[model samples]
Each structure stands twice: as C-alpha cells, then as structure tokens.
Target chain A: MASITLDTVGKIYPGGTRAVGDVSIDIADGEFIVLVGPSGCGKSTLLRMIAGLESISEGTVRIGDRVVNDVEPADRDIAMVFQNYALYPHMSVRDNLAYGLKNRRTPRAEIDRRVAEAAVILQIGPYLDRKPRALSGGQRQRVAMGRAIVREPAAFLFDEPLSNLDAKLRVTMRLEIKELQRRLRTTSIYVTHDQLEAMTLADRLVVLNAGRIEQIGTPLEVYRKPASTFVAGFIGSPAMNLISRRAVPHLPVAAQAGTIGIRPEDLSVAPDGPIEMEVLAVEELGAQRLVHGQTGGERLTVAMPSDAPLSDRLRLSYRLGSLHLFHPETGRRID
Target chain B: MIENRPGLTLLAHLVLMAGVAIVALPVWVAFVASTHTATDFMSGTIPVWPGPHLVENYARMLDAGVSTSGTPPVGTMMLNSLVMALLIACGKIAISITSAFAIVYFRFPLRQLAFWCIFITLMLPVEVRIVPTFQVVADLGLLNSYAGLSIPLIASATATFLFRQVFLTIPDELTEAARIDGAGPMKFFRDILLPLSRTNIAALFVILFIYGWNQYLWPLLITTSSDYYTVVAGIKRMADAVDGLPQWHLVMATAMLAMLPPVAVVIGMQRLFVKGLVETEK
Candidate 1:
C-alpha cells in the first residue's frame, strides 16, 4: 500500500560501533523486499531502522509521502512480525489479532470483523479461543501474521518470522506467506540470513555485507548476473566457483587482473573443455550430483546429471559470456 | 525415586518425621495452652493434653477479648493486622513493579546510578535505619495510622529486584511488538508486562503480607494508642501486664488467631504461589 524510501540510512551505536552504514533502498508500492546477509551484517539493523524500532543515527525513511524519521512506530502506520511470534502469551489468538485495533479505538464490531477475517485468512479460525502457549509453532506463526494482517497497516515488517519453525514447516509457511503477500499486496520488508529463504520469498533482495549493500536485484537477476564476488558466492547454491588468477594462470582475463566466477549449474562435463580438474568428492543430491574438485589449485564445483559419466580427472567448461569477473584490489564486478 | 533403596528411604522418612515434629512442637504447645484454663498455668507446669475450655477460651478472646489489658478486642486487632498486611503487600507490589519497569525499559541519564541507589536500600535493612524512618513518619503525621504502619515499610528492595528479574526475562520482541501494535509505553506495561508478571505478584504477596503482619519493633515504637496495636505487637502488651499476672491462655489464643490468616493464605494459594516462585521466567 505504500512505497518505502530509505535515503542514506545509517546506524552508529553510542559506543561508535557502526552496525549499519550509509545504505539507500527505494521500494515500490506493494513490493516484497528481503534484506539478506550473514550474522553481524546489519540486515536486521536496517530493517529495525525502517520499522522505527531502532533509532536512526542518520538519514530519512519515508513510508508513502511522509518522512517517518521522527514518527513513532505505531504512528508511522506499520506492523511487525517477530521470529518468536511474540503473541502475547496471556491472550487468545482472537485477542492478539484484536489488540492493535482496540488500541486505535476501532469500534467493537469492526474489531471483531477484522479479527474473524484475519483468522479465516490465516486458517486459524479453530484456534481463535486458544492462548498462544497452546498453539503449535506453525499456528503461532500464523497468529503472528494475523496480528499484522488485522492492523491493516501501510506496510508489514517481518524479522526472520519463519526461521524458528521446523524445516518442512518453514517451506510451507514460506509459500503461504508469499501467497498471502500476493493476495494482500502490502509493502513488506523481511530480514533473514538464510539465502534460500531470501531467494524464494523476495520480489527483490538487498544482499548486505558488513553494513554495506553489495547488490540489489530480483532473485533471478541477481542469480544470472551478480554485481560482485560476494553476490556471486552468496546467491546460488553450491556457490558460484570463484578462482583467483594466481591459482589458474592460464584462465582468460577481462582487461584486468582479478578473480573469475562461474556458477556450479553453468559448468558441464565436457570431453573437449579447456579446464581440467581432479574430482575430490561427489555428492548425490537425488536428480543432480554435485561434483566438487580441484582445477589447477583452484576449488571448483559442477552440477551434473546423476547418470553422467565420471572420471578421476574431469574436463569442465562454462557457456560463453557466463563468466563473472571482479577487480583484484576491490571485490566490485568488472563489465 | 530412581532406585528401590528401602533402607535409605526409611532413613529419609525418619528424618522428615523428626523435622515435622520439631517444627510442629511450638504450635502443639500453643494449642494445648489455649485449651486450658488460667488456673492450670498457676501450678507452674504447662499441660500437654487438650482441656475442656477450648470453646470458652476462644469465644472469650474473639468476643470480649482480655479486658484488663486496656487493649482493644483481639477481633479488632486482627482486623488492623489484616488491613496493614494487605496494604503493605499491595503498596509494595505497586511501587516496585512500576520502578522495576521504569528501570528496565527507560533509558535516562544516571539510570544505572538510580538502580544502584535502589539496590543500596537492600543492604540497609529497615532495622538498621528505624529511628530516622520513624522520625520521617512522625513528621508526616502518619504515626498511629495505617499509613504509618505500612508506608515506611513498603519501599521494598527485594520485591523490586524480584520484579526486575521477572521483567528482564521477558523477550524484547514483546515490547517492540506492542509498539508496532500502537501501544504506548504505559499501555504496554499494563497490557503485556502486568499480565506476564501475575504469578510473581501472587508469590510476592504471600511473602510481604506475612512480613507486614509480623512487624513488631516499628509498630511498638510508633503507635501510642490502643486502637493502632496490631495483633502481633498487641500480644506483647497482653503478656506485659500493668500490675498483675499475665493472661497466658488468652495470649496463646491470640497467638493462634494472629498466625491463622497468613498461614491460610499460603496454603490456599500454594499452587499459584509455588508456580509464581518457580516458573516466573516462563
């Protein structure tokens, strides 16, 4: 319902430890943006800043037409779902969904209507009377989502809301969340360290590294053409193979000295390929096998069909123009 | 429980029985004394067996009370004790919970200093600063009133610390969630923090009520009127006769009455009290 604009947002703790540096992101209305990074990378910090849960040390965050830099979180018209669900343990699911509306002095009938609607939407109708403690993990998560949904805020903020559930449940909940977002079409910013979750759930992802944004693109766009070595390794599974020019001296260079990147899925078992590698290990992953090996002192991984022929020394090649090259001094990608 | 060790189990049973006997002996003797006539104690030996005057002696204490002592009826004194106990328990809980919430959630200059200041009150027991506190109460014209009896003692370091510990264990996400849900700070405190700490309050109520009921030295020094005498402090006056032998039977009966309410509270709320004590963090 609202476009979020972060113009050079930053967070510096009182002790001078910078948690998040100057980073800007412009999110279109009804966009699903995921801030993904490793631990201590400041993805959560940026999300907190946007949610108004953390004090902004610098810059402005705008939700819709208003610059919400000084606005209270509640006044900023946003709702957040935490990883723990944080359903008031004492309240029933019905009360949890109705709490925000009641605080805003919404009419009693309206509160009931919204609460019932949220319960049905989240498929938590049967549990409306049960306290959060009695509900299962997935159910509690739905209540957490329901709490946000009932608020009808301009945007929704989620901080790794699916990370606490079981892996199987996590996938189901992830799909449910994506489908729900699609239906509601509310602007949302989700933060998580899990790359797979980020890729599957985001309309666009902002990959962070050390308080700085490394790249921002749609999932497929980031996968097909990463902006840096960090994005190259972080986006794809079996991590795009990164080789230093020092290790493979005979590899082609792109007008500069640096590392070269090739995704595992892009590599194939070719008999006449120029790259020669000794297979160090092979992992059978159902339909596809991951072939991990050494190519002239450089570690490489290739995704091949399960029934593909294997040898001690395998020849591998990537399709032309699929290579990603980064500067030697800096990790920035070269055109 | 994990093993069937009969000999060790028997030893444990014997030890437990001995402890129960040792603890129950005083109450048994007091009960036996209340059942006897005043003439029975004149023989210079206390009776162990129950006597026939049990109903008569209790009715006298509850209805007419000891008339010669110039103190009010034991019934009135028991009411005073109950009022004072309830006031102290409720007052301490209110002050401590708010202070604990403020200390834990708000960021103010010298907040740590303020916390350490409250902590210092713990080290200085009321017994250590009785006279100055008594002087303050006297200046405020609170002496001989229920306010005097409870207010000075309501600044509880232990209760504040207990509530602070409980509040600290609550997840930070709950607070943020409340903020995002459009709740102000006080609203969050009332709606979320208060409900979460209900068990802790119940447990602490049991402790503080007993503490307030059993207060002796402060009340003895402050209240000059018979109307303000708590049962626990009044029992002292009953034993210290002006010009005659002390009414031992009536004193024993009053003792039984004074111990009854708090003991009943502990027993009745035993489940919640134990839950409040043990599972406060959860």
Candidate 2:
C-alpha cells in the first residue's frame, strides 16, 4: 500500500562491525524487490532494518514519505513472513491470523471476517482450528502468509520464508506468494540466499555482498550483463565459470591478463574450435547435460543439450559477445 | 526393541528399581512413622506394617497444647506454609515471565546488561545476603509479614533465566507475526508468549513452589512469634519442645505434611517439565 525508500542505510553493531553499508533503494508501491546474497551477506539484516526490527545506524527508512527510523515495528504498518514460519504453536490457525487484529482492538466481527477471508485465500479454511504443529510445512508457510495478509499492512516483508520447504514445495509456494502479492498489490521486500528464487520472483533484484550492494537490475539484465565480476559469479546457477584470459584466445591483448567469465549454457561442444578440454565429469539433468572439464589448467563447465554427444577430448567454442571480461586485480568488469 | 536385549534390559530395570526405591524410601519411612506412637517409634518397637495408633498420633499432633510452649495448631502452621508457597510460586512466575518477555522481545537500552545483572542473582547464594536482605525488608516495614516472606524470595533469577531460555526457543517469526498484526509487547506476551510457555511455567512452578515450601532460614530469621512461624520453623519448635530428644514420629509427620503439595505439583507436571527442558535446548 505504500512505497518504501531506504536512504544511505547502514547498520554498524556496537563492536564496529558493519552489517550493511551505504545502501539506498526505492521500492515503488506494489513493486516486489528482492535482496539476494549468500549467507552472512546482510540481506536479512537489511530486511529487518526496514521492518524496524533492527536499528539503522545511519541514514533513514521512509515508508510512504514518513521517516520510520524511530517508529516501532507494529506502528510501521508492515507485516513480515519469517523463514521459520513462526506460527504460534499453541494457537489454532484462526487465532494466529486474528491475533494482530484482536490486539489492535479491531471489532470481533471485523477480525472474524478478515480471518475467514485469509483462510480462504490461503486454502486453509479446513485447518483453521488446527494448531501450527499439525500443519504440513507448506500449509504452515501459507498460514504465515495469511497472518500477514489479514493485517492489510502497508507493506509485506519476507525473509527467506520459503527456504524451509522441500524443493517442490518451495517452487509451488514461490509462485503462490508471487500471485498473492500481485492480487494484493502490497509493496513487498523479499530477502533470500537462493538465486533461482530471486531470478524468478523479483521485479528488481538487489544483489549484495559483504554488506554492500553489488548490483540492482531486472534478473535477466543482471544475468545477461553483470556489472562486475562478483555479480557475474554470484547470479547464475552452478555459478558462472571464470578463467584467466591467457587461456582463451580472441581477446584483446590488454584483456589477456584479466579474467574471462562465461555462462555454462553459452559454451558449445564444437567438432573443431578454439578451446580443447578434458571431460572431468558429466551430469545429466533431464534436458541438459552439464560437462565439467578442464582447459589450459583452468576449470570450466559447459551446459549442452542432452542430445549432444561429448567425449574426453571434447573441443568447445564460446561466442565473443557472451564473454564477460573483468580486471583480475580489481574484480571489476573491463569493457 | 525393548525385549531384544535381556541383559541390557535387566540392567536398565535394576537401575530404575534402585531409583524408585531411593525416591520412595523417605516417603515410606514417613508414612510408617506417622502411623505409630512416639514411644513405639523411639523404642524402634513399631511394626513395619500399618499400625492402629494413627488416629492417636494425628490427635496428638493437631492438639493445641501438643508442645509445652503451646505452639499454634499444626494444621495452622501447614496452612501458613501452603499459602506462602502458593503466593511465592505465582508471584515468582509472574515476575519472571514478564521480565523474560521484556528482555527477549523488546528493544530497550541496557537490555543485555539488565538481563545479565538479573541472572547474576542466581549466583549470589541466599546465605551470603540474608542479613542485608532482612535489613532492607525491615526498613520497608515488611518484617514478620507474608509480604516479607513472599516478596523478598520471589525475585527469582533462576526462574527468570529459565523463562528467558525458554522464550529464546520461540521463533521470532511468531512475535513478528503478532507485531505485524498490530499487537504491542503486552498483548504479544499475554496472548502469544504466555500460551507457548505453558510447559516452562509448569516446570518453574514446581521448582519455585518447592523452594518456597522448603524455605527455613529466611522464615526462621524473619518471624520471631509462633503466630507467624511456618511449618519448617514450627517443626523446629516442636523439636526443641521435646527437650532436644525430638519426637521422631511427630517431626517426620510434619515433614511429610510439608512435602505433599510440592510432591503433588511435581507429579502432576513432570511430563511438561521434561518436555519443556527438551524444547528449551532447541
């Protein structure tokens, strides 16, 4: 319901440990922004700061033009779905969804109406009287989502909410959450360490590393044109392969000493090509085969169609446009 | 599975039987002594089985002039002990739960320092601070009163520490969910924290109740008059009244009477206590 603006936000703990530094982001009303990073990369800490669960050591957090740096979490008009689901173990699902409204002195009829509506949306009507312990992992996650939705807050914050579910459930709940957010049109900020979730769900992905923002762009933009070596290495599955430029030909002489990055899928197993590799391992993942190999003392991985026949003495070729060049010393992109 | 290893199973049963006997020995002795005359008990001539002198012993213990000092009826002493224990138990749990919730859930300055300071009280044995604590109570005009007995001993660091540990096991998501739903700290604690902490409260109730019931030094030091004397202190008076010979049967019966409430509480809540301890670690 409200846009969130984080201005130069930073979190420095008492011992001078910087958890987040000089980060600024503007999320438009109804937009879904994801903060993605590895563990200890401060994505969850950033989300918690926005929720007012953590203090912003410097800069300001504004929700709908009002600075909320000093406001309490309950007064911030935001609901958060935590990674653990965090449902009240003792209360039935109905009570869990209605707890906040009851605390705010919402009318009994209104609370009941909202709880029923949320239960229906979550497809959890039958389990309304059951405690969280009785629900499956996915159902518990939905109830956590329902608890947030029933509040009708100004925004929704999610901190790795789907990470606890199994792979299949994670995918199902991921789409369910996206659809829920679309229908509700509440501004949301989601944090996760999973690149696939970020790539699939985010309107704009904010990649973070070591308490700093690495890049912020549409998932495909970040995937196709990563601004730095860190983004290149961090955004892709099985991670983008990086090798010394000296090992690969067709590069400008000045770029020969730097690092070259290539997506596994961008490499092809050619009958005769510029690079020769010894196949170290082959992983068949249904439609695609991931060939793990070595070329010129550098490890490389290439993804080819499952139909493509490969051997130990396979030769691979990569397109020039698909290559990402980075300065080895600075780890920054070079043209 | 249990029947697969007979030798190991027999050893387990032997250990369990030893535990049961060790636990039951005092209760059995107290019951047998309560059923006999003091002369038969002291002479060690009473039968190991039940006796016909139960009613006589009960009458003697309950009589107003049972002791030469004319101590109040034994029943009154028992009632006083029960009342004090209940009050202290409830009071300690209430304070501990609230304090634990505050320390765990709320963001206030000096929160960690406050928690550690409160927790350090567990290390300060009651014997070390008895004189100063009694002086403070006297200054507050709570001497020889139930308020003195309940209030001073009720600020339990152990209970607060235990509750805080229990509270930490609760997923912050639940509290966050409650907050986003618009519940403030008090509402969150009352509706969410308290309900989830049932097992902990039950466990702490048994612990604090026993501590209050078995209290001797504090009550003995605080209350000079027999009117305010608790069961333990009154038992000591009974011991002195018998010219230091101490009627073993009456003393044992009084001890057994004092043990009943806590034993009942423990037996009733043992399941929760075990579960609570296990969950607290998670």
Q: DockQ: which candidate is best?
A: 1
lDDT tens digits, residues B30-80, model 1? Answer: 999998998897788888898999999999988987878877888989999
In the range A50-85, model 2's lDDT, one tens digit per residue, is: 998888899999999899999988899898898988
Candidate 2, which CAPRI tier? medium
Identify the candidate with maximal TM-score: 1
Which candidate gets the maximum lDDT versus the true structure? 1
| DockQ of the two-chain complex in candidate 2 | 0.61
Q: Write down the worst ten-residue block by lDDT for model 1 chain A.
A: A246-255
**What are the lDDT scores of the predictions, listed in order?**
0.91, 0.85
TM-score of each: 0.97, 0.89
Flag regions of model 2 displaced more than 4 Å.
Answer: A251-257, A327-335, B1-30, B36-44, B63-69, B99-124, B129-143, B242-256
The TM-score that candidate 1 achieves is 0.97
Lowest-scoring 10 consecutive residues by lDDT in candidate 1 chain B?
A: B273-282
